[model samples]
Target: NVTVIDAPGHRDFIKNMITGTSQADCAIFIIAAGTGEFEAGISKDGQTREHVLLAFTLGVKQFIVAINKMDTAKWSEARYKEIIKETSNFIKKVGYNPKEVPFVPISGFNGDNMLEETTNASWYKGWEKEVK
Candidate 1:
């Protein structure tokens, strides 16, 4: 039998969590470069955040941190480096090796750092270049 599903762990449907985690071969983490951060903790009614952070924390082997929203932050190398610094610390706390982590800052809003020639990312290399 072969079936696949795509949905996050949440009160609306947390059942996916068990099956998703158990069956998935790998995971890709997509974080925004500027905003869209959902605070880590239980909500007012005690509902925990259904976020990829937990999955990443639990040790997803093939996690690629896609930092979206770079245009909003102005596509600066120093800013991206700062994001790397903070994310590296978080990855360590979540039981992952910071050295093995990779990051690519992309602006989904403006498509600035997208799948094309990014004029501003002179300081950082492209995503395909990361693995090699």
Candidate 2:
């Protein structure tokens, strides 16, 4: 069974995220490509802003980077690639092997590439099948 517990996203919930991650088998870090830092709520080190990023930075490779809100962004490939590159470098700085963790550009709100149908992200392959 997959347990999905939606936690608070504010700064006050940082502790909750740490605990949640500690007990979770896997996590999907959701983000928005168009909202800039609004999605992460952090800048500069990126770690300081993204509470979840902090989780992965502290060693949470069993997670998938879900780039959400692709629909609102009009499915901009450039935006997708930019965030991917930024996140990749951020992960590497924290001593993680980028290849181990998969980053998928998706639209959580529109169910894009989620559980419904394939999204506009045709330029990429899937990690679920690769893992299997």
- The candidate that wins on lDDT is 2
| lDDT (tens digit, per residue) of candidate 1 on 1-132 | 544546564566766765575565565555655543412322233222234454654444655666666777778777677767766766676566667666887777767655676776787765453343
Tens digit of per-residue lDDT, candidate 2, span 26-69:
77777667776533433664533465566655565576778778
Cα-based lDDT at residue 28, candidate 1: 50
- In the predicted model 2, the residue pairs found to clash are 42-49
Predicted structure 1, TM vs. truth? 0.65
- Residue pairs clashing in model 1 are 33-68
In model 2, which regions exceed 4 Å deviation?
38-42, 45-53, 56-59, 128-132
- TM-scores for all candidates: the values are 0.65, 0.76
Clashes of each: 1, 1
